[model samples]
Target: MLAPGIRVVRGPNWIWQNQDDGEGHVGTLCEIGRSGSTHSPEKTVVVNWDSGHRTNYRVGYQKQYDLIVVDNAQIGVKHPNIICDGCSKPGIAGIRFHCADCSNYDLCATCYGNDIHDLEHSFVRYQTANSVGVRVPPRQGALKIQLKGIFVGARVVRGPDWEWNNQDGGPNKTGRVMEIRGWDNESCR
Candidate 1:
């Protein structure tokens, strides 16, 4: 019974197929969240992915995903300390890609380039500072998409209803957008 908030790596034999539902298969480290029983106490787990998407699955399928603790959990929060295996840099910031199959080999943005890593290899990219969950491999275009309008790390004026941590700068406050999931459909209106 993997509890919520615990990160897990997908197993080799793991199978995920949801292309028809628009949320394609997920093959990255994901946090176990949102669980409950429906009919006969059959539990389910909602996987919170780094790509700003959530997927649900039966609870007993924990064996399909192996849970592992990260060594540089503070990399993104305190400081970008994870040395880039590709470049040997001291501080690798922004989105980082880690290969779970390759002993968690990590590559910084500069080294990653246009997802030049082994195409046959599977990777998971995540933000160092926040528990933004895990994302699939070959995230080259993700950089372009992120660089679009209102990318993460951009400053914004907090509205009166801003919720998370009101102590920073409450109503009419200003703060940096920690992460960007997707476009706001109503931002134009």
Candidate 2:
């Protein structure tokens, strides 16, 4: 699936021709339609154009693509020095989850999502490939808190707290958390 923040341009399959189409324009992907959603039965790639126009283009409708990827570096952070300990993939793509408790231990996004690391240890998330990592203080005691819930680089949804009108790509949509602020013990933003 094409991720948000990816740069894209009009593809050759874009059949629509308009003077306001802004040819040679580049846009950032903002949202993608869920495959099974009622609102968007077809795969839709929403883009925010640099020309101040926001619109969604078709991906697989009629087996054609209206947009093509120009750059995907924003989707995954590249780490030249890090190799995933779980999968042994070099230059871990996407978010790099480094074990705070283990020395020189790192896991790629896939391994981390699959729960490949020791759950007892907390991890620091690197959102960008070239991001400088910082150490997270070890949790008190040996409570063994499972690595779950909201965290930086975590995919999130509005859930039951949703009250606005499709603010986050509508129902069943998910977005990545770039940062957290003023977090409390209750985990309420």
Candidate 3:
């Protein structure tokens, strides 16, 4: 149903439609149609992040369609000894990536201040599944997070919140609090 190298924009939170009711659609920026946002004077959403145009929904609401950046994970905590995307030191598992021109290099929190980020990019990490969280069963009140490592080098691009975020914006805009993986409601003996 898809091809490689095709950048896609999807969300369970919102969708685009011919007639808005909060229903979104999937297509390149060239495919979306016109709505109020398509013609709004004060709105300036990026065409790459979100097509600067009109988006319909499931409800009978219509407005300038704006994209929100949120965490990637549904639930989970952070890992320690986190590696820096810049020098790739203090390497650890589960550290998040940082970037300024999100469309550019996949930099990390440590490297956010480095020359890679064109602007004064902010360094933030994600702890949600929507960003880069994983599931862990309750065993000994302990969990060891692992980075989605690659096979090229001892260092890997830390990672980033897989959100449709602005290259250089504020904190997470939206997402939900999901449950911990395999966390029993029962108390420990």
Candidate 4:
């Protein structure tokens, strides 16, 4: 019942007789990874019953990614975080509560506690503002940075793993299009 591309381990070859209930020719087989990115991977094959032989199979190569999300301190969950949280820096690990509602920058602890941002830690902004193709809310998540705009088929960039480095965290950002609701304030739709 295996597919053409999938390879199984070739089992022992035994003579077929009306005596054995486990009828039909079978070879225990295991699959293997493919080769080049554009080429198919290699695999091992088991010869049919009554024969002891080895064969080769291949699986196509594919790209993979390791993605992870860092959590914020105060919120204790995954949210958009700024570099410094104003300036004082956050938690020792440098990972803390990040405002999900963000525009282009983040407010460090100093800025948040101070009257600089008007006591508001996070805020959102529209992509281009004026009338365009899509109808999105003027305000978005303050810490969130959406690229292509919100739609079924929008452009986006892909990245791998979570960069917890406050210094390098900025590079973790990707051009992703997200559907969000603004009336709820920090709520991500």
- lDDT by residue (tens digit), candidate 3, 42-97: 22222222222333222112453333222221122233445444565543222355
Off by over 4 Å in 1: 1-79, 138-189
lDDT of 4 at 21: 22
Candidate 1 lDDT over residue span 49-130, tens digit each:
4333455644445444322222222112222567778877765655567776688477765566545566556677665544
Which candidate leads the pack in TM-score? 2
Q: Local error of candidate 4 at 110, Å?
A: 5.4
RMSD of each candidate relative to the true structure = 10.9, 16.3, 19.7, 24.0
80-125, model 2: which lDDT tens digit per residue? 7778999998877556788988888998766765668676688887
Q: Please give the lDDT score at residue 97 for candidate 2.
A: 81
**Strongest candidate by lDDT:** 2
Residue 75 lDDT, candidate 4, scale 0-100: 21
Candidate order by TM-score, decreasing, is: 2, 1, 3, 4
> What's the alpha carbon RMSD for model 3?
19.7
Summed over model 4, clashes come to 33
Q: Which stretches of candidate 3 lie over 4 Å from their true place?
A: 1-13, 17-38, 44-189
Structure candidate 2, residue pairs in collision: 76-94, 77-129, 78-129
- Displacement of residue 188 (Cα, Å) in model 2 is 29
Give the C-alpha lDDT of model 1. 0.46
Worst 10 residues of 1 by lDDT: 19-28
